[model samples]
Target: MCRLTFFVVVLIPIIFGFCPPGNYEYQTNCYFFQNNPTGFSTAELNCVSIGGHLASIHDGFTNSLLTQQSLSFFNASTDFWIGLDNLQTMGNNWYWTDGGTFDFFDWSNGMPENLQTQNCVAISMIDGRWSNENCFLSKPYVCAINSAATTPPPSAYPCSGGFLYYEPTNSCYGVYTHQEDQTWSNSESYCESLKGHLTSVHNYAEFRLIAAFASYGKYAPWCGLFSNDGGRTWQWSDKSSADYLPWQPGYPSGSGPCVALAHSGLINADCNQEQPMICKIQL
Candidate 1:
């Protein structure tokens, strides 16, 4: 009877997703820290592949929790990537990867400097405060799994108003047609306000779905692709892999901070140019 009780006590958590092994639970979420160092993009992908995203610091309590966990599992010299990043081309406003509002901030003194070059953020091992860094820099990272209800696929569930369910990707998409054109930065803000971001095309099928909604032979629409460091490195706003680019010939001139999809194909465009936009939400 004693052995059975002990086994049941240990098995309950795993059976109900209370907290997986090798993870710590704090306020309806599970967090895992990886010791291996990797770039910001790769780190984001790693977390997503495991059904989570990089940790998003909310308040002092959460910050303390993460800090204590880091100290417990890692050395004092270790720094782990968090989900906050400032990839928008216009402003230095940081956003969480989970699409939450930017309500809390805990930057170290004299930190988040060089806003133009440093786009990604990480938690410091010394004080557990936040600091901005170049996304290309490789580092260990923390993944956060929200304990809230799982998001059902588009086919399995319906989206809210103003969103169309795409069966192929199981995502909800919305097209924003503007009478007056807005810059890429402005469009991004608009989409975020609606709880989404500029559409990120991952494959030919997804690209075609977006294309079908676009006005034929008309101005292109802003997308999530852009040069993060002054045309040096291009990345998706959602941090997805950029392995499926289908740019038209002589396009992606690598001369602009924004990209748009026209009838011809994906093309580099000035970030300031006004255009229609597409926003996507993963179900």
Candidate 2:
């Protein structure tokens, strides 16, 4: 008889704080625990606004991690609002407000007194112990978002130009990064076919928006703005007045025949370098 043996190795990824700015990572979750004191309802609302919910700990490791973080930041073991609650079903098994599975509980001694008035849950920053509390009490909180979450683009709005609409200017704008990178001139030409020009940044809002896109996509986008005659003058390809210039600080490094939206701001990029682009059309 032949004997065969196989050995398997499991690797638990060591990715601490692999979350977005102002967040910490544990296992597969990103936590944004902070010192913003608010009522349980208000805290949940705040978390929801940022694409997450009050933190939910399903395992002892996570509970300990959250407790340690709270201690490190707030310097005390005070109470911090968590996602567990029984507001909807008093005197029954609690539920996570974020809808996570309630498979674990770390109640402090004499917890869940099952008082009629106490319908919310909180975790002790001191040692990760949980306790029941009145839902109206204000407390600091932890919000947990999916580590795999993404910065989703705006929902596609119906417009005649087949792109997102800018109600402020009665124009349509489009960002095209999915296509193969192309020279700035070619980008502008493609926009021309759609009866548009490289998009212009008329205000700070558009500037920040393009900057966000560049940061997330890891690619600068060609715009209509360009400089000629040694950076002394710049103009938009569509003949619009260059009313706004959100250039990267200490940039224009040199006179650029072309410009692209960079993470920081507009930067002079070699026109021939293939890049993505944003276009706009007055519909």
TM-score for every candidate vs. truth? 0.53, 0.48
The true-structure Cα RMSD of candidate 1 reads 15.9
Model 2 poorest 10 in a row by lDDT: 3-12
Q: List the residue pairs that clash in candidate 1.
A: none
lDDT of each: 0.70, 0.71
Candidate 1's C-alpha runs over 4 A off are: 1-16, 148-283
lDDT of 2 at 254: 70
Per-residue alpha-carbon lDDT of model 2 for 59-177, expressed as tens digits? 99888888888876665438899887765445476878667789999988998896677878998876778899987787888988778765444432224433545445656666676
lDDT of 1: 0.70
Residue-by-residue lDDT tens digits, candidate 1, 39-123: 6756765565455668888798898788878886767346889888765331347767666778998989998799877878988
Q: How many clashing pairs in candidate 1?
A: 0
* Candidate 2 residue-wise lDDT at 158: 29
Model 2 scores a C-alpha lDDT of 0.71
* Candidate 2, position 122, lDDT: 90
**Cα lDDT for residue 256, candidate 1:** 85
